[model samples]
Target chain A: MSEPVVATDMRKLAATQLFALIGFTVREARNKWTLLALFTLTTLFLFALATLVSIDVVEGSIASARLFGTIPLEIGNTTIPVSDAVTVIQVAIVSLLTTFGLVLALFVTGNIVPLTLQTGWVDLLASQPLGRTVLIIGRALGAVAVVAVTFAYLFGGSWSVLTWKTGFGNAGFLVAGMIILFTFLCCYSGMVLVGVLTRNSPISIIAGVGTWFMGLILYPLHTYAEWTTAFDPGWKRSLASGIAETLYWVLPKSLELTENATRATKGDALAWTPFLASMPFAIVCIALACWWFSRQDY
Target chain B: MNVIETRDLAKTFGGALGSKVEALRGVDLQVGAGEAFGLLGPNGAGKTTLVKILLGLVGASDGDATLLGHRAGTPISRLEVGYMPERRHYPGFLTAGQVLDLFGKLLGMDATLRRQRIDLVLEEVEMSSWRNQKVGGFSKGMQQRLALAQALLPDPRVLFLDEPTEGIDPLGRVSIRGILRRNLEQGKTLFVNSHMLGEVELLCDRVAILVKGKIRREGPLSSLRAPNPEYRLTIAGSDEDAARAALAAAGQEAESVPAPPGLTVWRLEVGDRSELNNVLDATRSAGLEIEEVQRVRASLEEVFVQTINEADDDKAGAGGPGGVQTSAKGATEVSVATREVDNV
Candidate 1:
């Protein structure tokens, strides 16, 4: 008597749902005014940077930098090679973006998981012809996309200004955007897990920021703890080694990832230990969140 | 075939300190295709929980259910299912048109198809005039209409509506009822969970009454409330004393029931047809004219209240249900309404 409801193709439905989730979240972010805030702040920062700083290049090898036609740049030399100067600017830009962007972006986007699984919304969402895995993945990626836009705008804008003023392009600087993205995903995965578990936005932010803070603290602690493993007394070495290894393996390597972002400036090889460990941390966090979410009782 | 069916389905929610609240006891139910089935219950009666389980929003603790003959909660089952949740919550940022566009895409509609269906559903929900209006600015009733529109977007085979008219005004309620009736005529299965007995009576062909997670009464609407033994009589005039004296002589008494102009209606119960004849004979001898006679029956609201009161009495005698913590605020006393459900 009733139509089979068009009998949606299973695979096609998943893809459609995924895209719809992204579009839906973007609309939500727009309404929340978070996206506008990101755009505004990024624009002001780029505007100030463009107006205040000027780079003078000679034969693409050496350059003099000045701020607002008044103060001269300081470094190991009055004139540095344009290539080296680009690298320095790249490191500075990546570090600044990751540190400040992490706070603002995660604070704003921390509502993603809980909002996706919101009471009335989830009732309709989970009932759709899509897998639970797809639902959570779509929501996570949707939040990432919102951040991605801001990252591209702010980071790309800074990169453009550096190249335009110095008249030397550093394509490697763009790759550093990849590192920042992974760092965000790692922290966001923790927030997703917390959101799925508790549906608390503030706690979600804390989970993400706390894990990032832990990564910042643990990277150095583990490095030294490894040193103590070779030099400290046997019992102390064993205790320190055990705690450091567990934590280093369990948490995301945000500081180490930042180092890799800096490495991207010089086009250096990434440190595999932190990079590899961080990947699994994000995957595991999100997988656990999805597993729990699928079994959740609304 | 049964479009919606539950076989010994049950759900128990875990509370703090190892306590459990049995939201649904062992329950079996079946609704056929093209059926307008109403799920009736008081607050905290597991009505909402049942809908949630079928949609996979909440996982069932035990047993299983199906939608349109597929395992309930599966993506395949949901493909042909549309649900209107009790709480009408949508992203306030989205316009009504945008909301439909998103939902249409989720249903795998292409850009052109999405556009068409969005327009069609907007018209259906009486939201065409406000398609571009942001949901944040709309009243609750407008939001309710938007929610209903989304559920109808995919032309689903079965619709699960929970309190479909909760925030609507009187005229809007009538319009919604008409839409639901039209859906039924198109042979769509409707599973409605609502407290509005008037609406349920108007829209449902069959119904199940749930109390404390159990289906106490379920059957065709006509069978659920059969013809009563009481009869209403329209007397020629408003002569209460004479009618009472005559009926009292026949060992019966009458209660006044409101009537239109021309005759006064009096209601009285009779044990058999013979007693009815006697009352008529006594009235005639007392010079009172009997203009008309009609059987009296109960309203759905009356039936619902009586069922709830009976369940309460039964629960009191049975010492209440298990796994109920006293501290749980505003929870139902009985965790399980019945282990065995009989439609009869």
Candidate 2:
């Protein structure tokens, strides 16, 4: 029973404990098959990009693309200009990364909070000298970090591969990766809030996907899908339109974010409305989750 | 100073449809520094709730709980507290050493110090050999030892163990008992929550018997296991008539236990100490030699059962709920306090 004197400061102590919690979350993330599968896919894509795929370049433009050294799909000889096709490829990559990262992250992390708060685990962590808010935030940030690293690997490696072979690259895809991460962050906050409230993983994921759906269906009808004409002209339609518009303002502007991402690929002036509106939703979710986690007992 | 204290502490858990469970109702208790305290109770007796409050796992609905002079659940209060939960679960992927290192970091230990302490605690719990092995593959006993090792990693001033011996073998129990006894010797406090009366009787300097969320009995082991008011004696000679006439002179009678031809053994119910001296005088006056005198004592198990029955509103015969009936929670029939070794 020897007592050791280290004279550690409070800030250092808090930081150390936060790091410890994050480290544990990472360890737990490694155990989850969802993360593992995502990691494996990202690695495989990187391998194929670096090894199997090749592009023939002509005057700083992608002319032909070959997959596993197959007969080149002719783009250099067709009417399609190489630059527009590369822009399409870049946006397609951004969409692929965003859609896959969002769905997989939202699905897997639905239960992450509840799982961390399970009986034995919660009992152990709660008894530690760290605050409740620190515990929750650390785990969430850890999951975010895990996703960030994985997405960065996929996005960065693909950009490098495409640039090496075809002399075509968009740094905007890297920025788009950030946007994807932010989008996932917004969804993650809601997921955590729901999981904390209900302590049910399934319900948490449903609320998360439901939020994404609402953001999609509740966007300005005419601006996104031109759906206002489909409804018969009446007070009922007005009421629906009014409610959907109100809800859309409060919800994440997901579809608009997709458009902004496309704008990013073109190196064009991007709309800030979607990014600005989506931020507050994330802030509110995180604030509410932190408050609830602090007050509630495990 | 008291390292742990609760004053009129109360906790009520909300149940379904507006129902409530009063887990702890006005429990007042204290444990001084460097003391081995045992909180013993049957299942659903609020032992878990009380411990949870002290550890800051749950909020108390009423009253106050303080740890190390800070409000329970505050960061400062748990600075020097070490807790071993009833259910042992560490990240299955982490090695034993890694688990200790992580928990050590939680205590804000530096890498140099954490490494030093982890190695030391691993040796202390005899898990040094398994330091690099994943705990997921360890047996329950090994995991139990590793759990203890983590609790000891910080060298906490107060150690709280819930069923430390649950999955350990008898020899491992002995090993843990020795480790805890040494901790007490080093002027550290040990608070144990267990249903095993024998464990408490062996390890605790003081015990509180909790029943149905109320403390029915609280005191030292010596006072709770009050000795029975009877004595057994082996006399050198066996002459029933001579012994009876001498006993009648002192107004005392003895129940003779048949013995060997050379010795006379009898059991006597003595009203007081002076009466026991008178019986000895009477036996000597009858020219009989006294070989041995023994006093039978009530076991702690018996005390626990009787206290529980008394707390059930004097249902001394009816037994309490959940069949806290006269089974002594699976204990030996009688306990001889003098024979058991005192490790603390």
Q: Give the per-residue lDDT digits (tens) of candidate 2, residues A94-187.
A: 8876676678878876777888778777887788777787878888888788778778887788778767766667777777778778778877
**Deviation in angstroms for A274 in model 2?**
2.6
Residue lDDT tens for model 1, A170-262:
877888997898899899999999999999899999999998988998877777655764647878778877887788789999999888888
- Would you list the C-alpha lDDT of every candidate in the order shown? 0.81, 0.78
Question: Model 2: residues >4 Å from true position, as ranges?
Answer: A1-8, A51-53, A56-58, A62-70, A76-83, A220-246, B227-230, B233-275, B282-291, B314-344
For candidate 2, report its TM-score.
Answer: 0.88
| Backbone clashes in model 1, listed as residue pairs | none
How would you encode candidate 1's per-residue C-alpha lDDT over B143-214 as one tens digit per residue? 888888999898988999998987688899998888888888888899999766667777898999887788
Candidate 1 chain B weakest ten by summed lDDT: B335-344
Error of 1 at B155 (Å): 1.1
Q: Which candidate is the best by lDDT?
A: 1
On residues B215-270, what C-alpha lDDT tens digit does candidate 2 reach at each position? 77888878787644667777777677777677678787678888888787777778
